[model samples]
Target: MKVIHIAGWSGSGKTTFILKLCSHLVHRGRTATIKHIGSHYCALPLGKDTTLHFEAGADPAVGIDDEKTSAVFHGICLDDALNLLSDSGVRYAVLEGFKGMPFQKVHIGILDGPYLLKNPEVSEVLSVLDQFDDWYTPSGLMKELTDEYPGCHIFSWAGYVTDYQKTKDLCSRIEDEYGDDPLIAGIRARVHRWSDDGRYPVYLLMAMNNPFADAAIFFRAIQKIEVCTLS
Candidate 1:
């Protein structure tokens, strides 16, 4: 899953950027946009199986739209939505509101905290102030931390994370070390459309708290290599 996320304040143009990115990527070939409505509630149709099931107290009632063949899981993590998005053939995914996710945050500019994070699994993270530790599906931090993810989860955008010039410099390093078949090609970063104070939750709960504490002991086990390169 190539996940490219936009993080910033509400009025920072995140939404507009998402639209533009969609158009840009669509011109390129294939891509899909996914928006995160963190902590928001939607009342399922009264007669729908999903709604009925939830009312009947199913821990998480999952519903499927026969016409569109789309599945909806209630009370599931935002990551769970990723599972669905990946399977749907969305080659390039644009994450509109995953400020707390470890996917390289693509901001319009500064990650204004009000629109950046929420419910961080890692302490000390107050929106724009911290990077996501990627707890549930533990990302690179240290070996003990990697061991906890339990599955071989590939980086969402191991081939298209674009932004800083330093990032471009890193790509050159990867090419020199790995040869012509380097994964990244160009910078994929873009200025977003939402930049105001947050209208959505920035943080969400993940599994762990302090991956860094464990990171210190297993530094060699984790490699902070960029999985995705810009376009």
Candidate 2:
């Protein structure tokens, strides 16, 4: 997931630009989510059931209907929201305001600041999409941990398997080989999307011992997985 912040003075066409960019992304078969930060306080209707539920101590109040579902969560910071979007497989995350936050920016109007684009069209932004910062995800977090701990031996795999039965057999084989091994500290396998054909974006992370522990004690945990065939 990538993050882009659209910032400018009030009434500077930020909203219009976002709509156009999102439409283009949809046409290209990519997913995008937006977060709008406003300066004023926006309140819900006084007698609405959702508002009542919030007033009755529900931290997050949700209302469901046929067309859409509305949810309001209190006390969540900006980074937390972006992480949620990344975990849900959003390809792009756009921010209407929040110029102060440190991320790539697309300035508008006569704003005096650093930006990747200034009042440019959607295609221009798409051409330079790689300039934006990547949002947080479990895989990214594990990579960061590996960088921090040089002694850690990490084996990670992500792929699209078109055979459902073969995927199951592979997972069972891994667990049977490593489930009782004391040296292995963590094993994570998740299917991000599944269909009749099989699963796409399956992620597996297996680490030997706790990388955060003393390096000397975990030195023996780096032994090779002799029975491992997922390489």
Q: Candidate 1: minimum summed lDDT over ten consecutive residues — where?
A: 198-207
* Model 2 TM: 0.60
RMSDs, each prediction? 14.8, 14.6
The number of the candidate with the highest TM-score is: 2
Error of 1 at 62 (Å): 7.2
CA shift of 6, model 2, Å: 0.8
Instruction: Write the residue-wise lDDT of candidate 1 on 92-206 in tens digits.
Output: 6677776776665566645654433332221222223224222111122222222444432222222222343454455345435433322222111111112134221111111
Whole-model lDDT, model 2: 0.65
Error of 1 at 204 (Å): 32
Q: Tell me the deviation in Å of residue 202 in model 2.
A: 18
Question: lDDT tens string, model 2, 179-212?
Answer: 5667665554444332435444445556665545
Tell me the lDDT of candidate 1.
0.43
